[model samples]
Target: MKRSKLKWYGAKSELIELTKALIENGNLKGKQEDIFNEIQEVFNIELNNIDQAITKFNTRNQENETKFLDTLKNTLSKYIKSKLEKNR
Candidate 1:
């Protein structure tokens, strides 16, 4: 099947974190670079210097390190709550 190329405009760190999480959780197989290449092909985005980006993400202050993941959690929580309320 042909895949459409969707551009990713978010921070590279966020994408890197997500990629690592997928691998760590056993949701995806292969090395980081391989996964990154797949993502790039699928999304038509360029992800360069992944190792360096990950290093920067790790060194960030506690509050900023997982900002994107935290945002996702909060957004999903709100969506679930809204759905539950609507079902009442």
Candidate 2:
């Protein structure tokens, strides 16, 4: 089955290019399980950053800003998860 392209701004594009570069530069030379585990760690780090950002924005319009950021984080994380699952 064909996978659908994610629409989380440049995140998915950057991720794909980085994965390509890793493979091309032989940085990703490892067993499939090892690679999958590494990718999961990357996603977890990114998600934590998003969580931090959401907490960092505490200005007047905090609720609005947080909602927007939460949306972005959800979409981005979802995209990353989909890409990993698709590859598997």
* Candidate No. with top TM-score: 1
Candidate 2 per-residue lDDT, tens place, 43-83, comes to: 54232243233234444275654444466579999999999
The top-ranked prediction according to lDDT is 1
Question: Which stretch of 10 consecutive residues in model 2 shows the poorest summed lDDT?
Answer: 45-54
Model 1, 27-60: lDDT tens digits are 9998777889998887777888888988887798
What lDDT score belongs to each candidate, Candidate 1 first?
0.83, 0.51
- Model 2, residue 32: C-alpha shift (Å): 5.0
- After the best TM-score superposition of candidate 2, give how far the Cα of residue 47 lies from its true spot, in angstroms: 12
Model 2 lDDT, full chain set: 0.51
Candidate 2, residue 38: how far the Cα is off, in Å: 1.0
Model 1: how far residue 47 lies from native, Å: 0.7
TM-score of 1: 0.84
What is the TM-score of each predicted model, taking all chains together? 0.84, 0.30
Stretches of candidate 1 off by over 4 Å are 1-3
Error of 1 at 20 (Å): 1.6
